[model samples]
Target: MKHLFGNRVIRLLLGNDLLDNIAIWIRNIAVLFLVMDKTGDDPVAVSLITVAEYAPIFLFSMIGGTLADRWEPRRTMMAGGLLSAASVAAIALAVRYGAWETVFLATAVSAIVSQFSQPSSFVIIKRHLKEEQIAAATGLGQSMAAIFLIAGPVIGTAVYARLGIEASLLLVAALFLASTLLVFWLPRVPRETDAERSGGLWSDMREGVRFVLRDARLKTLLLLFALLGIGTGLIQPLDIFIVTDRLALDKEQVQWFYLVSGVGLLGGGVLAAVTAGKTRPNGHWLVAGGLGFLAVSIVVEAWSVWVPVTLVSRFLVGIAMAFMQTALSAMMIRMIDEAYVGRINGTLAPIMTGTLLAGSALAGPLLKATSLLAVFALAAGIVAVAAFCALRLKDRPSAVEAADRA
Candidate 1:
């Protein structure tokens, strides 16, 4: 673990991801409270902000991933970080001006920039790390993500409460700038080899899509992925409302829920890393199990308005989510050829975001027509269906590490 950070490039990139993720989370918290303050936390307004965050992944990830394949990862990432900083700065200015809509606009644009940034990071890690080192690097990344996801909301909301929205957003901008600076020293990685090249961007994209669809198991896995997206998307936008409106927790205390679940996420990452060499359970089952756990959590949260039960269930949800996603990623690393890794994952972004969009769209109507408990039960039912599909999944252990279990 210590040696992993000893490598200069890995250290820098990991720090970049850490700072970038924290910046994004802080921005999201700021956006959530900003809209709430401006619009009285209107459901439609909140949904729109969340949607804006996801829309670019649907629209631009393929183009960005294709470019990532063709360009230098470090430079592309640097450009992305600069754009992110500018976007945050623009939003900070927007906050000062009371231009509520521009906040959403800025969020969407930043998301578009992120489409480029994320793929480049993926390729950088895949290319730079040795095969054996990949899992450890991934574990490290997830661990940091868990930690930052926990801290971001707590720190971000505190900043907003203490310093005001404008100052908090400026803080996000500073983090983005810091992230960009960290990448300045990363060595230039080479472009794809002749054998790695696809004919053109469109052709490469089509090929990536084709590659993903050709495998029945991959198709099945994506179906489960879509289900997970839909089920959770329905839950996420309403969380603040559920806290303040439903559970009646103060806005400042929302961090408590995040704290509990984030601790679970960190613990899960640690547990998975400890077990990775010993137990590479079938990836599909892990995902299915995770979804099932989320379903159970939703139901538990809905069972009573009592906060402690909901908190514990949410913690379990975090643990389940970490284990599931880590398994799914390891499967991808093991099964996919290196050349198409960027594009294939890129194309899947739409599948994820699109279903989430559908789920978000459904949330408002569900709330209007039914109670929160009903909505959660519906989410549970949807996730159970995903789990059934996962149970039907036929993906075998193909990666050397995972295959050892088989």
Candidate 2:
């Protein structure tokens, strides 16, 4: 593990990743609270921020992927990072002048650039990391994500509550600046597709789609990822409402929840790192079981069991998500050609975000019609089916070979 970070490029990219997530987490917490304070906790109004965050992925992910494939990862990452910092700074200034809508606008603009940043991260991984190292990197990435997830919200909210939103935004902007520097420091590796890669953006996107469709394994994985998206989306809309309205948790209690879930995610990430190589044959099971337990946890929360159970469930869900995401990411890196990594990732962004958007919209309506328990049960049931169907998927010893042969 120590040797992994010994690689200069890996260390820089990883640092950039941590800083990037820190900024995102802070921004997310700030915007959520901002909308909440402004609109009296209106779900629809606050939800717009989320919608804005994801809408850009739907609109620009493919283009970003194409660009990543064509451009140097370091250059693309640096560009995106600087642009993100500038945007956040702009938002901070706007907020100071009493422009609340700038939060959503900034979020949307940042998200649009994020389409480029995300693919570039994967591009760095694929180009730099060896086959044996990929799984470990995935686990490490998940751990950083978990740490940021835990710290970002707590710090962001605490800073906002004490110092105010402007402070939170400034903090996020500082992180972004740090991340941009980290990106700039990363050594540039030329892309594999620079010479032969040509054609319009739409044509390149079509090739990406055709490439995935040509492979049964990629096709199946993509479908499962979509289901993962829907399952994730189902619970998201209920989070704030449940915490604020149902549990009536004060700000402090929310921190405790974050602590428990962060610990869970950290645990899961460590476990995944330890088991990455060993879990290749049964990666889908990890995802399936993760999804299944996630649904169960959601149902349990809806069952009106808040305290230790809800806290425990949140932790377990973190574990599940980390396990699933780490396993799948490792598997994807192992199976797919490095050249297609960006496009494949970009291709799935929309499916995930779209379903999440839909779920957020639908869950509210469902809550109006049914109890939270019912809504949770629906998500659980759907994911349970996905898990069961996953059982039918053959555990190919060589997913890449299987895809190639197909």
Residue pairs with backbone overlap in model 1? none
lDDT of 1 by residue, 378-404 (tens): 888988998878776544433432433
Q: Tell me the tens digit of each residue's lDDT in model 2 across 6-64.
A: 87878987888887887787788888998899989999988788679877888899889
- Deviation from truth (RMSD, Å), model 2: 3.8
Which 10 residues in a row give candidate 2 its minimum summed lDDT? 392-401
| lDDT scores in order | 0.75, 0.77
TM-score of each: 0.79, 0.84
**Any idea what lDDT model 1 has?**
0.75
Candidate 2: segments with Cα more than 4 A from true spot: 29-45, 91-100, 158-171, 192-195, 239-258, 292-307, 368-370, 391-406
Could you tell me which 10 consecutive residues in candidate 1 have the lowest summed lDDT? 395-404
